[model samples]
Target: MKTIEIQIEDYITNDKDLISVIKRVIKDKKKILLQAPMGTGKSSLILDYLSKEFNILMAIPNTAQIETIEKRNGIFCLYGDKQQKGYRSETTVVSTPDRLLQATECFKTKNIDCLIVDESHELYTTANYRPKFKNIMTLQSTLKNTSILHMSATPQANLTCLKGFYDIFIKIDSKKKLKTSIDIYDMELNPSNIKNIINKYKTNNNNTFIYFDDKSMNEELAEELNLINVNADNKKNNEILSEIKAKNKINENIIFTSVIRAGIDILNEKNAVLIICAKSNLTTDDTIQLIGRFRNNLSKTVIIKNFKNEDTEKNNQSYEQILNQKKKYLKSINDDIKRWEENKIKYTKEDCTEIKKKLTELIEIFIELNEKGEKIEENHRYKINTHRVEISAYSQLQKNKTKNIDNMIKLLEKTEAIKIENIEKKDLNKKANKSFNKKIQEKSTEKRELKNKELKQRIEYLSNNLSTLQLELFMEGSTLKTLEMTLEKGQREDRELRDALRKTLSVVEPKSKYYKTIQQIKKYITNDIRDAFKYITQRELSTCKKDIIQEQIIRNNISWIKDKNVEIATDIIKNKIIFIRHFKILQILDNYGLIKNSSRISKKILKKIEDILIKEKYFDGIKKKNYQKIIMQDLELIFNLSRNNKEIRISSIKTKNMNIENKKQTA
Candidate 1:
């Protein structure tokens, strides 16, 4: 065992808030979520707080963060020989998520007392839970005493979406003074733009960080700069520090890095210029994190988007990928639900009701959290080391239907199409309905008006909650969602069958053989499905035709893209049934233009995409919902369905083959 030591200064000793919170969490042994602003010395504070007792395992995103941590700790603790890897007692072991997951393959339990996940927001933002998430979850379950801490620079930037699952929360307040005015410019990122930025900002004494999501883009841009380019891989700690600290440089030195905000932070006060290229497949949070690196500096941030001409940008454009995936997700669950039902997989109404209740409760908590923001600290019981502490944060946004009253009110007011009020309103002077009549019903002017207002608000709340419930019904990524999808798929498929039968009947006479088959199929549908499709082929003939066309579009649209020229297929899509197929976004633009020419996509396009995927007329995003609110639900639903579908298919296929072999042997 060796002693763990770190450099402590007067500023660190004086700052009681950071040290107190860390000590309190450590003492209580509760899982904490540490959130501090940029350039606040979070790593330094953490190092200062821990002594010889706590064995720490820190999972980070980039190796640059590892370098930074090593420099602060004055030693590295990688997963190899402890002595050889420069590991001492209470040394913080750091590695990227993928690497840590790989190294801990034979792990039954974690010996480390605390596990801290840096950039914790990535877990929620990703499409599904990666191997690292699974490993951590297992670690949580296996190591009963392991204190799992999820830390992020959430407040003033974004909320940690995964906060609901944890037991503790801590938000640190650090003030950053603007010594130099930050000038921000938004445009496309390209070679010409890069050259212009370099020519303009590359002064002799200035230090610049050109951030990129893509490694190739970072390398290419660095090459384009034609300067002394250095990154995390090509430098020593002292050398890099000296290079950065060199105040009298004749020419500007640059370090173009992909690892800007994902743990690699430099505590430097040189004239800093940030060229943040927000022009990549990276999410909005990622872009914000990158740009936030220069938040503490007298820095100028140039946000050059990854823009291209209309033709070139069309291929890699980010649109409604989730909504399209949601439909596929639903269809995938259909077979599994069917198989589960056959296999007698027990599910009860009571179970569903209980789950729904819990989900609703979580959602409401989140809604209140997002609305309340920092204000709700007084309302809720939060203990952070004897201080009334609150960080820039969002509420516990659980992946369920949470009610936001203001947002709900805005929605109800905007849409006259669907009145949210459930009450049957009579005239102010007229007799009240017996349903609304009370035992001692006496209506005064003020009382009546107040009652009416209360009723309206109640109705709006009901409407909002109902919409959330319905949308979230199939969106939560669990067996519950799969079951919901399976239950709804019957109706969805029935509608299609009805439309198919109707279309066939309309085109064919009573004497036609195909008409009889269609009639028979209708009978089968009626007998098999719950009387939902009894009169399907008769009234919904046009709807059936539209469904037929939509299904065809979904099926053939892919082959058309692969084999045929897209422009020539105008005749195939002449009926304007592109939006009908929720799975595919047709190039056929309306007044809003379904696809925008601008680098940053318009909100209208997003709405169109939502409507095409989820019901636009529905609560999913009709009232201007954020992506996290909508997409998390969709992701959860899709993940469960996709996972269950694969399992069921594999199981059924294996069983069928075994039965076939048995029958062949007997024969």
Candidate 2:
């Protein structure tokens, strides 16, 4: 293979020479390997210029990049599960490698003139360690007929594999240097350390991006610092990037993982990068790619931990040694499979089943090892004596010392590539402790105030509603009592009047005019007395029904009040209150007139209540089993219920009715 170096400035000013070289390589039907620093217009050269000349199929690293490239260049892009139809008909199409692998049949039907693998280093660095490496190898085999162009800022691949097809290797060295100074803090990254760094940066009013590999930790830190976190799962990444690029004054800092490391550009001059490197899996190349995301050539600050992983450095093995082990493992598995095949006839059914399970496990391991070995041979054949293709930043930095970083960081003191400082542990502790204590106090005060406010509001709501319900119940009780007393008094008077009339009729009905007049008066008095008794009896019955309905309303209101209080209760007391309130409510409802006569509350009723509570935004995060248990236990206590297996025996309690007619007749 021939190697050529071109100045990026010269190519940008007059790219006829580089274009001529690409043309010559194309004429010779040789694949091209283009290496250039990030933010030097690699994607632009392909999509804007190269596509106009030749039919190109650019394979991006991710869907976000695919969308970004499509939107910026107005090209046909395909990715994800749903791909655009007839993408092969377009002269220039962009897609992810996985999407390309999935659409192998479509590509085989049409000709892809030249395949550009953007960020192609991922083939060895990322996919080599995963199951998808096999798919990538298959993709390489499937597209072997097409001319390939591999491009990246930090390129690492199997030179032996490419030597057969890729004859020309071009490296673009940029004349312009980044105006970013890196500060290497020799400390571990914890919540406290991170907060101190963020607070320091925040004091300067500079926007910051903190990079951490753990998504959960990133989110926790983001929440603690009140910053937006962007990751692979965050759907608003594009919007966040757009806001940052547009210089919108939003959050002073943002937290991110590896999702935005490459293929995305943030052209903000005032932005600073803070990378937490303790116990991380990021390579030096990845770190550079992350720093390169800020495209502007203005002076900026970059902070990273000077973390060194001694174990990774000490345990490093040569690629050849690892490859030999994998090959040996594969050979052993193959031998085992051969032996199993030969002796299978002698094995019983049970033995065969066990053997089949073992064989299946071994086969999966064999496939993984075989694919890994192929990838190693293709990507790391030339680097047999070196460590694995992707070296951790800690190992890489330790190996290279502080003088040079593969010509990437350069480690020049004048350029401030690596700034090492002796940060005092006591000072950091003091500052972190002070900040932490202050935060704790602030949060405590805030929480206390919030709790009080919430408690006050809940009390106000429940008290006001409860008071109204209690007053209604009181009024109904008082009215019912008054009606009963008045009915009794009227009945007594009616009885007295009827008795006197009867006596008068008995004594004077047989006589002349005087006796007849007494009889007439007696009859009138008896009829009047009867009418009054009937009216009082009817009124008493109506009052009794109203009182029953009113009592039910009061019970519902009380239950509702308890439910509302559950929200304001402390965590330590929440479940206890829930159990007590839920139990009481269920007991009342089981025997209440709303449900038909049943000793035990049915699951249908429980579920209905649950649905109502859920709709009302109650019982959040409570387990369904716990809720059911509470209700069931209460029902058992109320109805003297017993359970035998799944069957429940609940003692029936007969409902009572008011015998108002009997009382009236007696009176």
Candidate 3:
């Protein structure tokens, strides 16, 4: 083991206990606890003592003060910041517990000589400590000797209960006398009260630091002091830091800051007034920390707090009105109970116990949920979070109570002995009133009138769109050109020819098979609607091998060269993938236009084909129907997007839901 001399000449005075304990702890290698009130310069004394020989990593609670704390402590140390990524090489690292926990894996301090945890009371704040504690404790494995020095004015109870955590306790005395005065006020928590507090107490302008527990109200507080140039565009932290660093000793700078509490230290705040938002049961350590900004005896703290009323009325009603409603409800319930007792309702012991047991179980389940809720709500009183959990434990409890009452009533009515005629008669009498009968009659007439008006409007809308949607009941007598001029007209179509699918390519399976020949023919088309618009030409049909007819109507058919990218003629000849009711030559001509190479193509004809394909639900829809789905005057239009759909374009309709599975729209 190597020994080094500790030196801090004339740096610390009067606090002999602080100096003695540090020396003893380093010499003996034992865990020690230190408690020193704020403004005592305890941090400065220790940093100077350890900087000469040992590398110190000071765990700061306030991340905003990383630069200030390092400078005030008189130690040039690295902190957890974006620019300081190379912190691994730094001899002294100073940052908050949360920051250190994130970068713990980068630290290679084999047996740390000393670990100082600042704001040591946070060691047990479950939210503050849980994640960071796991990483901070890793120092125990890295430490060569000496103990972890936990420092705070008031150590939390959880850490103090741990056995063998600290061997010796040290309390440092501040040479400067403590002088602070606090004033409590029960002013309402509103903008008016805040303005008054600022006007009455803001002495020597902008020297006072204001803090609010609620973050949502912080913006409003800043607005109230907007004239001080504080409501600038700068962020809350940057604005406050610049104001504190300004040369003027706090005057006429409207800086609304939410900080100034906790482990933050402000050296320039001496003789400055402290306006705090405090609560009941204030601790001595907390008061010292809050007012510790000024080391001078002249500085004072004024607490302006208002008592919170959790049970305040929610509506614009008098107290008497609320009381009357509560009384009426209770009286009605009491009357029902009295009547039940008078009626002498009978029930088996087992049945009654079962009902009681079920009710108890419901109550226990609600209690369990509420217990979990409380654990989630556990947070620092000052740093509370805002959230909206729609259901409250009280509301849920009330609902459960109502359900239990209804269940009990139903069970009583079911029992043969418990005749509930008295309760039923009273409820029936309220419904049998003359005014109730008149109200029901009027409502029924209004509903019938509304329904009739809707039906008439629907009939008129359908009649208007009927000409646009032409339907054919019998295809044999249709006058459409495509159906009448087809070559399959004069010939008996061979029903059973060996129709074999030569090649197979399965990308996605359909949920239902629409065709028996191609068991699951799920087609995915990506080309433009106009590309597949080409019907077989008369000349091309003369040399065609076969035709595929759909629903006794002849659909187009054409031969397709299987592969387009063939280096040799043999490969091109071998791969012949033919599509039916779809002309490959027409699709090729349409796709060729996309390459910007063909100028001789007839665009007018291509557009006509494209319009026809759109009517078949090939592309997206608009307010207008696909013109191709319409003949000159005999268009059989299925207004819906799906193939073979029943929805006609004649009526005003609504899609309940359009579910898509693998890009297939299912309405």
TM per candidate comes to 0.41, 0.52, 0.41
In candidate 1, stretches whose alpha carbon ends up further than 4 angstroms from where it belongs are: 1-13, 53-55, 71-76, 79-112, 125-130, 155-160, 177-182, 203-207, 212-225, 229-262, 267-269, 291-296, 306-667
Give the distance in Å from residue 270's predicted Cα in candidate 2 to where it truly belongs: 3.2
Tens digit of per-residue lDDT, candidate 2, span 1-667: 6889887562342476777776567556567788876666777778777788776777787666776766667887767666455545467777776666544444545676677788776665551233443454565566655677888766644342233656778877766545555544545565677677767665665666777776656666677788878887674645786674454544446787776664666765455445444344444555556666666642434444544424442235444433444344344434544444455576544333333333333223224234224312222111121112222222333243322222223322322112222222122443446566466556656765664465444333322332343323322223333333433344445544333322223222232223322222222212332221222222222232233324433543344335423121233123233433433343345335332232354556666655655554345556653444444444554333212212334433222322443365589
Candidate 2 lDDT at 222 equals: 75
The residue pairs found clashing in candidate 2 are: 158-379
* Predicted candidate 1 versus true structure: per-residue lDDT over 1-667, tens digit per residue: 1111222232343576556656666666677666655455666555656534566666766555566566656644343222334223434567666556444432334366677776676555442224344455455566556677776654321232332455565654433322332333334444445556655776633666666554444444465566545554454543543543332232244555553354444444446666555543443344445545443453454444433323232233222332233223322223222332343334444332322222222112122232223312222221121100111111111111112222222322332111122212111222223432221132333454564465444333322332343323212212333433543454445544333332333223433333333343333222322121222222222233334334444644453345322221333322222222221332212223321221233445445555655543323213644432343333233223332222211112223544666588799
Compose the digit string of candidate 3's lDDT tens values, residues 1-667: 1222322222233446547658667667766666655545556665656655565666766665666765565544445454554545445567676566443433464434567777665554322223344345566446666467777655532233333566766644443334554444544445455555655657553466565444434454554465332322344546544655432244332333334453444544455565555433233334445555544432445554443423323322333343343333323323332332333345334333322222222122112123223312112111111111111212222222222323323432332211123212101111223553354446555665664465334333322322222211011122333322332422213221101000000101121121111211111112321111111121122112122112111211111112222112322111111121133333333345421232342445445555655544333323444332222112121112124223222222122321122135333
CA displacement after TM-score superposition, residue 334 of candidate 2 (Å):
4.9
Clashing pairs in 1: 155-392, 189-305, 279-306, 363-402, 477-636, 499-544
Return whichever of 1 and 3 wins on lDDT: 1
Q: What's the true lDDT of residue 237 in model 1? A: 49
Query: Global lDDT of each model?
Result: 0.41, 0.50, 0.39
Ranking by TM-score: 2, 1, 3
